[model samples]
Target: MPVVKEAPLLDGSAGRLVRLYTVSGGRTRPTASLDLLTLVVATGSEPPPRSGPEHAQAMGLCRGPISVAEIAAHLGVPVTVAKIVLSDLVDCGAVAARPPDSFDHPTDRSLLEAVLDGLRRQL
Candidate 1:
C-alpha cells in the first residue's frame, strides 16, 4: 500500500493565504468578526467562481451547522485566520452565521421547571 502522509502545518501557508486574502479585499470590512462558537452554513452550493481557494473550501465545508472552531481545525489554520477568511465570506453573503443560542430570556416557565425537575431527580 502507498504510504499516507499528513498535510503540513499552516506555518508559511497561513501567512501566504492571509496575504492573498487581504489583497483580495478580505479586509475591506474590518468590522466583520465571527464568534468562535457561531454556526456557519453555506448559502449556495459553492462559493463564487472568482473566490480564493480558501474561501471555496470554507464554503464547501459549511454545508451543515459547523462551528467556526471546527472550520479552523479542518482548514489546518489558526482560529484567528479562519475567522478572517470566514468573515470575508460573510460579507459577500456566501455563508450565513448563526449566533449561539442563549437561554437568558427563559421565556417558557414550563420548560425551565421541567429542567429543574430533571436535575432534582438526578441528585
Candidate 2:
C-alpha cells in the first residue's frame, strides 16, 4: 500500500540521504530510505528501530554498501533491527551510498519464466 507521490522527480538509492520536493511545493528531506529493500527493512514505520552491535557486525560481514535488510539477514536479526541501524547511520552520515546510476538489480529468473510462460500460453 505504498502511496505513489507522482514518482518523485529525483529518484535516489537506498541508505543515502536525499532531498526531495513534493508536487505540492513542500520540501522533503531524507526521513529514511524507501526502496523495496528499505520498505522490508523499515517495516513501514519510523523513526526506525534501534541500532547495536549487530549493525557493526553487519558492516564487517558485508563489504559493499549494505542495506538494512541485508545487514539484518547477515546478523540473523530482524529487518526492523537493521533498518534502525541504517537510520542512525544515515543521520550520522556514516554509510557510503552508490550513485543512482548503479541502481540495478538482477532480474528474478523464476518470475521471468512465469511471465514468459503466461505470454506463451496466451499466444
Candidate 3:
C-alpha cells in the first residue's frame, strides 16, 4: 500500500518553486538519456538515508524493470526532473537503465512512403 500523508497546504506557485529549489541543490544529473519507456531496475537495496525520499521510493519500485514515466508519476514530479534524480541514482550505481528494445530509425523510408501512399489512396 502507498503511504499516504496529508501535506501542508502550499501557495499556488509552490510546485515550480519546489522543483527549482531541489534541482539547485547541485547534484549533477547522469548522462544516460532517460526516455519515458526506458527500463530501470534497482541495482542496490534500499538507498542510504542521505539519498532522499525520491531515491528510496525509486529503489523500492525498481526491484523489477519499470518505466521512467511510471516512476515520475509515482513520485509526482515532472519527467525531466525525474530523469535528473534517476540519473543521480544511476551515477551512484543504485540502478540500471536500459533503452527501449525497438530502434526509432527507419530501416526503409521508401517502403514506408509506398505504404503511406497506398493508405492515402484508400482514404
Model 2, runs deviating above 4 Å: 1-31, 36-51, 97-123
All predictions: root-mean-square deviation over Cα?
Answer: 7.3, 15.4, 5.2
Residue lDDT tens for model 2, 1-123:
988653332335643122212111232333456342542222222232443444455446435544555666665544554555555555555554332333576668899899999999999
Summarize candidate 3's per-residue lDDT along 40-108 as a digit string, tens digits. 999864555587666777788899999999999987777877787788778778899897665555358
Winning model by TM-score: 3
Q: Which stretches of candidate 3 lie over 4 Å from their true place?
A: 1-20, 23-30, 45-48, 104-123
- Candidate 1 displacement at residue 81 in angstroms: 1.0
Q: Clashes in model 1: which pairs?
A: none
User: Between prediction 1 and prediction 2, which has the larger lDDT?
Assistant: 1
| Candidate that scores best on lDDT | 3
User: What lDDT is reached at residue 62 by model 2?
Assistant: 39
What is candidate 1's CA lDDT for residue 17? Answer: 29
How far does residue 80 in candidate 3 sit from its true spot (Å)? 0.8
Worst 10 residues of 1 by lDDT: 15-24
Question: How many backbone collisions does model 1 have?
Answer: 0
lDDT of 1 by residue, 1-123 (tens): 999884532456454324544533645333465778888898874456776666777887998889999988887666776787788788788888887675334458898899999999999
Model 3: lDDT to the true structure = 0.75
The per-residue C-alpha lDDT of model 1 at residue 43 equals 86
